[model samples]
Target: CLTGAPGDAARNAAFLVDHSDCPAVSLAGDLSLAGLAWMFSRAAGVVSVNTGTMHLAALAGAPTVGLHGPTNPLRWGPWGRNVQSLLPHSGACAYLNLGFEYPDPPVTCLENLPVSDVLDALERMGLRERAFAGD
Candidate 1:
């Protein structure tokens, strides 16, 4: 299932489904907050950027992976036992604080984060059946 808010969520779902091996469905912009929470409770795992969706997923007891780039994980990351937060390796982009103050210029966006890191995080979180196969 591909679920999130509109805009990037819809585009992301489309892009993923276009390249996916199996079937995929998107609930972006189609679900209420309660609906989202219920859906999250049933999901095997959820990977979300720093958004309310991430917090909701964690609150709903889903294994969640929160991706952080220009935001500090310490301040805005998902909270729970079944959660993991992914950040850039250089640690240069996490500057946002109090939703206003930023001490450094943005060095990169989430695009710079490696997919391998995400996969590894899922594996560590036991969300995936197994580690990603070597290519």
Candidate 2:
């Protein structure tokens, strides 16, 4: 999550920790290239929005999966053998209105994405495995 220089970084980190069991890491607004390299070296797989971090992940040679919301995946999705992008249908524009005041709208665009869809994509990318055997 490339949180621009804003207070949203801590707030988003808190939300991620409270809502999901997945561990979350938050970087300060100005991150150095060395810091990013360190993170990439330790990451098993990178998942991120269609942001610069996604490009950095590709440069680091990590298997990356990027989520597309308001943008078209065809035009903006990362280009690399180790990267996969998941995008909603073209007609689905719910994410466009995010951060805007709305009354009783359905779940956000990303929330509407089914888990099976993400899992299938991950499986195809070889990010998920059925088992590991000892030598």
Candidate 3:
């Protein structure tokens, strides 16, 4: 599942999920925070960008993979056990968190890390194994 308001990003993500063969669904603003927490509690694992859901999922005790871009994982990664972080190797935008120093953050430097990197991280964390094993 996914989270976002009805916007370009949400529409685009829905488009991708609809076209892809992955057994996935996108949930936008249809859920409240409590609902999200409940969903996370039921999830075997979760993949999220630098967003609240990532942290929530981790707190819910789900194995979580967090995609960090502008923010440094050391300072902002999800807090919990069974959590893994992925970030861009090196880039000017890598640690540029949005704040007074960087009032307007650029598009995610984390985007430099490709989808393959996420898949690989999940593989290394054995999320894929647990998922396919139906654990």
Worst 10 residues of 1 by lDDT: 126-135
Residue 82 lDDT in model 1?
92
lDDT of every predicted structure (CA atoms) = 0.82, 0.65, 0.76
Which residue runs does candidate 2 get wrong by more than 4 Å? 1-6, 25-31, 93-108, 130-135
Each model's TM-score? Answer: 0.81, 0.64, 0.78
Candidate closer to the true structure by TM-score (higher is better), 1 or 3:
1
Better of 1 and 2 by lDDT: 1
Best candidate, TM-score: 1
TM-score comparison, 1 vs 2, better candidate: 1
How would you order the candidates by lDDT, starting with the best?
Answer: 1, 3, 2
Superior candidate under lDDT, 1 versus 3: 1
TM-score of 2: 0.64
For 19-117, candidate 3 gives per-residue lDDT tens digits of: 896565667767778988988988878998868888999999888999887767787888897899888766644454453345354454664788888
